[model samples]
Target: MNLKEIKLAPFIKLIFIIAIIAYVVLNTDIMGFVSKGISPVLTAFIIAYILDYVVRFFELKMKVPRSLSILISILLFLLILTTIGLFIVPRVVGAVSSLIKAIGNFEFDINALSQLDFDNFYLNEIQQAIVDTVTPLIQKLTNATGTAVLIVVNEVQKITSGLISLVISFAISIYMLGEKRDLLARIKRTLFAYLSDQTANQVLYASRMANKIFKAFFLGKLLDSTIIGVLAYLVFTIFNFEYALLIALIIGLTNMIPYFGPFIGAVPAAVITLIANPSSPIDVVWILICILAIQQLDSLVIGPFILGDSVGVSAFWIIVAVTVGGATFGIVGMFMGVPVLVLLKTLIEEDVEKRLAFQGYEGFQSNDIKNKKSRK
Candidate 1:
């Protein structure tokens, strides 16, 4: 084909789009600028999205005006945040202080292992080896107490420094909630103006799917984590576990990450418990048991009830997503990976089925695969 006769417009457009994406991805300065500049707006949008449900409930269920509903939702959000600041924050800080003090004073008793009566020589050797291994590890951790405390202080400073940005974001969220309909209408108008009807409809449908998946996953996960945290706190309090508030907070926050969160939270909690009462090694065992029980309850009952196939992905994929996302983008990625995977999975499946149908072939659905596996 003659070079001029071959239509290069579509290829050029594709190349331009790819080049733009590559530039954004590869440029560190641009990435930093986007993160620093756009984070507040992104935060505001997320806040408005989450609070939209509460606004809707108030408007539809209570016969409240839309403006009044938005105001109430914002007030409720502020109330919850203020309560956490007043109550939870202080306790967590105190817990951290106590933990640091305890770690500073902690000493591993290597001599204690000599007092243990082991019938077998191998058992005695194994016990000694464990003590020898754990002693240096504990000493290293104890020595790093100051570093840990400094890190905590630095994090607190960062939070305090970000307050202005947070306030701005909150203000932005208020405006977003107030003018949600107009904003959405404008978005739709722009999309339709720029794209064909079918393409615009597809974009809207995908966005709605994403919203549903994200809302369900996030809200359900929050509720589920809250319940687990409360239950864990109660259990810890009953058992007189040390640093209950701090550990509970860790568990709650980490629980937002799928698959690996329980284990991640449990390790630090168990370590803290063990360090607090090294003489009573059974304390660590008790802590582990309690955490395991709470996680089981969450996984078996509360999580299922709340999430209820909202992720729409299998355990293997969820694990893969969480692992890759955590590796690539840290905790936020870990928490978001599942819903993103679900959205992508849904879109791909739909497209594949459509293509298969066009090719005069019936798609091999999920149920068919399940039946084949059962036969195997």
Candidate 2:
């Protein structure tokens, strides 16, 4: 190994790798080609990951055969999904239809605004101007909402267009689940072959911890959102709110996001309420209050029970993750950002602690460390 050869060889390899990446990224056709193949692969990975947790529970806790457990878990997942679809879809469709019709004929009753502040001339003028300006905008907004929903529904129905791809993904997931043990063993063996025992163990531990954090975030968020959604639906329906199903569905889904989720869901819902009941804008205020109450309950009670320290990151970092995620990858990015941040945070913390311990610089000592010091 000549000195020049050793140094230049690495640079040459790096340049080659960068060139290939640049070509792939810059060439739209090639990028699209790559993207077309990525969806199924991603979907399968997601399916396998979610099912792995269920399969493990059945195998370890119930002593079920792994194969049988996988089957049962998959079947149960499908059943729950189908049940939810059957229940929520029809009601959402009906609500959307009613909402569209109502909005199509929506009128901002200036008289109602006047009644709220009869003696205030400036307020009345502003109210009149708002009524004139906002009425048409409201019509356009509702019409657009209805059109967007219909387009999404159509796209969903057209999912059968990619049925073959979906089936392939499911098959891939099934194979992964079935061979998970062998797959994991092979991966560990390869890791050990490539690295020291300590390095390989650290890698495995980090991988497992990442998987655990992701599972906790995704599963807990899903359950928490579902509960919130159900509660929102119940409360809205009990209050006889128009478009209850639609609003609740929005609230439920948005609740998956961290701090801003409730407000994100509530604003549109309040708008819908006001538009649906222009005669009494008080409904909008009441709905806002209702959302506040629900959010309080979620933050104080439901969220803790379901999501308890899932990310283990503080609020500021979570917000940063969410913002960056949303900016980069849209909604899915926003949904996943926190868990990814959690994994990164965990890895960093582990590495820092290890380095600190190796240097014999422990400020905040653990119980074991304190005990050892006392013994010494």
Candidate 3:
């Protein structure tokens, strides 16, 4: 090759490499492939991570043996899982059966509407418009009942697979936890072997921050959801709502999704009530009231207390994260999106502060401003 052609070869090769990577990412199921490949490792990491906290509490505070601590933690975890299963499974099955039986049989009747006399022309016109809207909405709801039932069944099937995966993951995690110190030492050695001290420290710092954010967010959410779920159960029992256990479980679980969680949980309960007791539309109204009351308490009181500054993202960004995460990874994505956003926000803020400090800027960091105000 000529001198100029030889000089351009590296640039051409770099472009080709970039094009190939982009094409593979765009055209292939790269995410699915990666998820399938790393799922076991990821699952193990999560289990070990959670168990570490419990194991540490036992070993450190309770002065239990490390091995004994691990065993205790696992047993406690299993006990909680079993208790929840016993409480939730039977009710969920019964609710599903009732829903299936009630579907396709539900009818909408507003016969009393015809007897209403609206003397004002504008009021009459508005009444007619509302009736017209309700007619089609009811028809659509009727048609969707079967689909809803199938969706619940499909969700259960996913749960079954998830449980199997969980078992395998926990098995791996037990081993990891048993070898925690060795594993951590090995990981640190590997990082330092290949990465410079500064880079290794940066990576470790980022990982620690991410872990802290995730743990805090998840624990807070779990407590919040549990409280909301209990409140829902109490309300349903007080009001004599059908499928109380099943509906309350739905509310509790979906409450993990954030922003849309309450409404999402409410929809199924409302739909089932409407279908099973067409004559008692007030029950649906009461259910809505219960949801609103619990959510208000959560948002104004419990949520703020438990999860304050955990996500760091504003409500709008949280909504966007939930939407994108749900679209990309379904329920798991929606659950994780907020904490991931928090980690990213923290990293960005720190990077910005570092850059500002490097540029000889003062009092630019958020903490600095807050400190100044507190001093005043």
Candidate 4:
């Protein structure tokens, strides 16, 4: 092919995009620059994205003016922050301190083990092993607690230093929300300027899909987890469970992680309860039972009601997403993994169907598969 006759525009654009991505990924200086410069903007976008729903609720449902809706959403957001800072943080900190202290003061009763009538050699060895492990285990626990506290202190310092950025982000988010329509229009205009109609439309569709998935997953999960946490706190307080606030916070935060979250929160909470009230092992049992009931309620009723088909993936894929995402990017990854997977699944399915149709191939549609399953 003649060099001038060959269309190099698409290839050039693809190379430019790949190069930018590679540079962002592989260059430390560029990564640092992005973190410093773009972090606030990104944070602001996330805040505005979340608040947009509340803004819409006020504007559309309550018939409030758009500006007034934005103002109300901002106030509500600030009120929630104030409440968490004033009431929840201190209690959670105190609970952590108390838990550490309790762990330190806990003593394994080897004498109780000795009181058992089992005289087998294996039993004796097992008892001896337990005796040997207790002291080191306590020491390790103390060290881990200290490390965790130090990490929290460091994180607090980082947050304190980033307060200016937080303020700026808040301001940016407000502006973004206020001019959302114009901002979106500008973005769409830019996309169409550089891309063909088909490509631009695909990009727009993907953006919409991503927005829908993220909004539904994050907002629904947040509401569900908050309710679960409140219910847990009430149950714990009524039953006089130890570290109710702390355990409830743990449960709520972990509940943001799908599938494995309840178990993760329950394990640590149960361990703490058991350690704190060794004399009354029955209290641990009750705590476990209560947590189980709460999880059951969430999974059966609350989660389904709120999340619905937001994550249109199977349990197996969700588990895979959570595991892979967590392994790759920690807690944030775990929380985001399902929706990301769902979006990717959707886009891939659409592309595959398009290609199959172009090739005149007959294939099973997802809706048809679902209909068949329902009929069965």
Model 2 lDDT, residue 45, Cα: 84
Clashes of 1: 0
On residues 1-376, what C-alpha lDDT tens digit does candidate 2 reach at each position?
2222222354357546864775555455876777687878878989898888899999999999998999999898789868867997878877777776776677776545545764778887887788777767766775675676677688779778677787888889999999988999999999999999998998899898988898999999989999999999899999999899899999999999988788789988987898788888899999999999999999999998887767676678889999977776678668978897787766665655665655665543554332211331
Q: How many collisions between residues are there in candidate 4?
A: 0
Off by over 4 Å in 3: 1-37, 110-133, 144-163, 327-329, 365-376
- Runs of candidate 4 with Cα error greater than 4 angstroms are 1-33, 110-136, 365-376
lDDT of 4 by residue, 232-265 (tens): 9999999998899989989998999999999899
Enumerate residue pairs that collide in model 1: none
User: Candidate 3 — which pairs collide?
Assistant: none
Ranking by TM-score: 1, 4, 3, 2
lDDT of 2: 0.80
TM-score of 1: 0.88
Ten-residue stretch with the least lDDT total in model 1: 367-376
- Per-residue lDDT value at 284 in model 1: 90
User: Model 1 over residues 1-376: C-alpha lDDT tens digits?
Assistant: 2223434465357546864774555455777867788899999998998899999999999999999999899999999999999999899888888888888988767678767979999999998888888878887988988898899889888996599899999999999998898999999999999999999999899999999989999999999999889988999999998888888888888899898999999989988997788789889998899999999999998998888777777788899989976776577668877887787777766765665565555554655542211331
Best candidate per TM-score, number? 1
Local accuracy by lDDT, each model: 0.84, 0.80, 0.81, 0.83
Please state the error at residue 360 of candidate 2 in Å: 3.7
Against the true structure, candidate 4 reaches a TM-score of 0.83
Candidate 4 yields a Cα-based lDDT of 0.83
The digit string of per-residue lDDT tens for model 3 on 1-376 reads: 2222223354357546864774565357995687676798889988788878899999999999999999999999899889868977777788878777776677767656645788988987888887887777788877876787889888888997898888888899999999999988999999999999998998899889988899888988988999989888998989888878878888999998899898888898787778778888888998898889989999999998888767766778789879976776578778977887777667765765665666665345455333211331
